[model samples]
Target: MSLSEKVKERFRRMFSDVFFKRYILGLWMMAEGLVYDMFDEKLHVIKTLPDTFDRIFAGGDYGINNPTAFLLIGQKANDFYVIREYYYDSRKHGRQKTVSKYVEDFQSFIGNDQPENLFLYPSAAALILELREKGIKYVRGADNTVIDGIQLVSNLLSNKGGRLFAG
Candidate 1:
């Protein structure tokens, strides 16, 4: 199975549980930093997990403070949604070693059947350029409308505004 297929499979398995269904819904919003909570008559927007995850996952490569979460967002062969995420611990290796490990993990997850349409939301320009150099086909997720749509979905999830996966 392709990476996208694997991700969709995982989602299906996880989403079957009520707890995970709620958790994933919450995570979608947390990923986009769109949740607001009331405190002392004041409303505050919560910081999304992606911002922190991106920070820890990008730049300097070693130590527990390093980036641990890597998310792969795209579409699967069956036209189902695909979102895969993995984590790495910098405490186990040096900077170079950890980076290499991440690259290897990324490559393995991607597999050989390269998707004609893949997108990445890299945290840094250097990483983006590096991926380009490696000849991986991708588009910048920052300015992409698809990403914006995901963000909107995330917001709806965070607010607990409606049901998901329901017609």
Candidate 2:
């Protein structure tokens, strides 16, 4: 099949495996929006601990102890989610280096050629500014109303068993 078809099939399989089995919830509303479309009484919400206390409570040997940031891409009108969670290593890494790594990762994932039909949250503006300094192009976050609209569309499509983009 074509490359686009392959990508769609991969996304379908990943989403089904990762998201279909559970309802997504988060401490912040933005994260909540990531999987809110699938919310159901049977769904389990992963408890979110406060950032400050979470680390303290985690004790030693809990791996990285920092507030991780996420990068999410959702199709406009369709609302299919591709979320990337990134962590900061203040002790050994700087923000610019972290941003550069993320940009590289994003470019590798989506390719150098930009797609016209994509939406991204702008909370990463500082990172985006860094990207702009390095000559990358990207958009910012949508308003809450827009997110709600997309969520509604996503829920309807999911309920109807309508795949966002099939292979």
Candidate 3:
């Protein structure tokens, strides 16, 4: 006799080891090879930024209740350096800034520098709209996949052919 669908589901839930193996064992396995010191300060920190770059770009993370941050990046050949940063925390400052104010901050942060692209947090629709209205060119949402982003950064840092550094 065939079991009912509900009974089959219950049986699978009671008997299956998928969750235990995938979540529990997987975590332990990943922890073993996980890099604790991905960016060695001596190797990846710069005291001075180059005068010229092949490409210039910016990245932003827009937050209202949380902290907001932006990075001005310059690239020469295969190396990328963070030339400047802007960070604001409303909670710590005890005052929240409006969307217009944030947009103004973004503009001020950019100054006369013309970034080739402005990559932003994928969910920051309001901020993106404001920047687009301000005639910022090449404003696009960044890839939001955590694991893929982590892997890409790791590869960049680990490879001798290219490097990502902060100043």
lDDT of 3 by residue, 33-107 (tens): 445335566777879888899999999889999999999999899988888899999999999998888889989
Clashes (backbone N, CA, C under 3 Å), per candidate, total 2, 1, 0
lDDT of 2 by residue, 17-136 (tens): 235444222122333335544443333222331222111000001012343343333343422333223344554564334556655654555553354432334555665665567665
Give all TM-scores, in the order shown. Answer: 0.39, 0.38, 0.74
Best candidate (score: lDDT): 3
**Candidate-wise lDDT, in order:** 0.41, 0.41, 0.80
Colliding residue pairs in candidate 2: 122-141
**Candidate 3 regions with alpha-carbon error over 4 angstroms:** 1-36
Model 1, 96-155: lDDT tens per residue? 333445556666665643444434444445555655566754535443456675666555
Could you tell me how far off, in angstroms, the CA of residue 166 lies in candidate 2 after the best superposition? 6.8
Clashing pairs in 3: none
- The regions of model 2 sitting more than 4 angstroms off are 1-97, 145-150, 159-167
Q: Provide the lDDT at 33 for model 1.
A: 39
Off by over 4 Å in 1: 1-65, 74-80, 91-101, 116-123, 139-141, 144-151, 155-167
Worst 10 residues of 1 by lDDT: 51-60
Give the lDDT of residue 156 in candidate 3.
Answer: 72
